[model samples]
Target: MALNEDLQLQALRLLQADPARSQRDLAKALGISVGRTNYCLRALLDRGWIKIQNFRNSRNKRAYLYLLTPQGIDAKARIAARFLQRKEAEYAALQAEIARLRAEVKADAET
Candidate 1:
């Protein structure tokens, strides 16, 4: 399933913040339901954006940690650029619309 832009960005940010975070911790940090977090994480994993590796914690037992693959880093960079471009375009359009509306209001007031 295609995630909304906000979800995508959130997932990227959460991963960036702590690659070793569990899905539960990530869900809490993102203020999203655990199911949704799991879904998004599954999508990311399927896309090869992250890899789960077994590592021993201080307790010496094996535990899993998520790591961003090289492809994941590239994806993050591309997403960031696209997000910036979209925001810029949206700002420009809103500014033009505001100017147009102001002009119309001024003309109406004069008449």
Candidate 2:
């Protein structure tokens, strides 16, 4: 299955920590591809969860840096909280499922 909202939140966290990161760098960090990273970034930008700023890099006149806007920071905070809650819920559900499966297996063995 595709990565859930939790992973997306994690991506935001990474971006927040290092706004100057390139798509390739982010992909490497996230264990995804550059293309995928670009896709995710576009989605975040569209949702106003992050932003891109063009600032000249000291090392290269043509190179630019990206910075997060205030709104992006707020959105990251909100999304991070929501992602944590959703992850907790998913974990609980998985635990319950495992318990149910174990019980079913035990019942079958007993029978």
Judged by TM-score, which candidate is best? 1
lDDT of 2 at 71: 77
Q: What lDDT score is found at residue 46 in candidate 1? A: 91
> lDDT by residue for model 2 over 1-111, one digit each (tens)?
354576577787888788878778889998888788878887777767776776554565544345566776787678778877888999999999999999999999999
lDDT tens string, model 1, 46-76? 9898887766654534446777788888888
Candidate 1 scores a C-alpha RMSD against the true structure in Å of 2.5
Question: What would the TM-scores of all predictions be?
Answer: 0.79, 0.66
Backbone clash pairs for candidate 1 read: none
Q: What is the total number of backbone clashes in candidate 1?
A: 0
Model 2 lDDT-worst window of ten: 57-66
Off by over 4 Å in 1: 29-31, 58-64
Off by over 4 Å in 2: 1-8, 30-57
> Model-by-model lDDT, in order?
0.81, 0.76
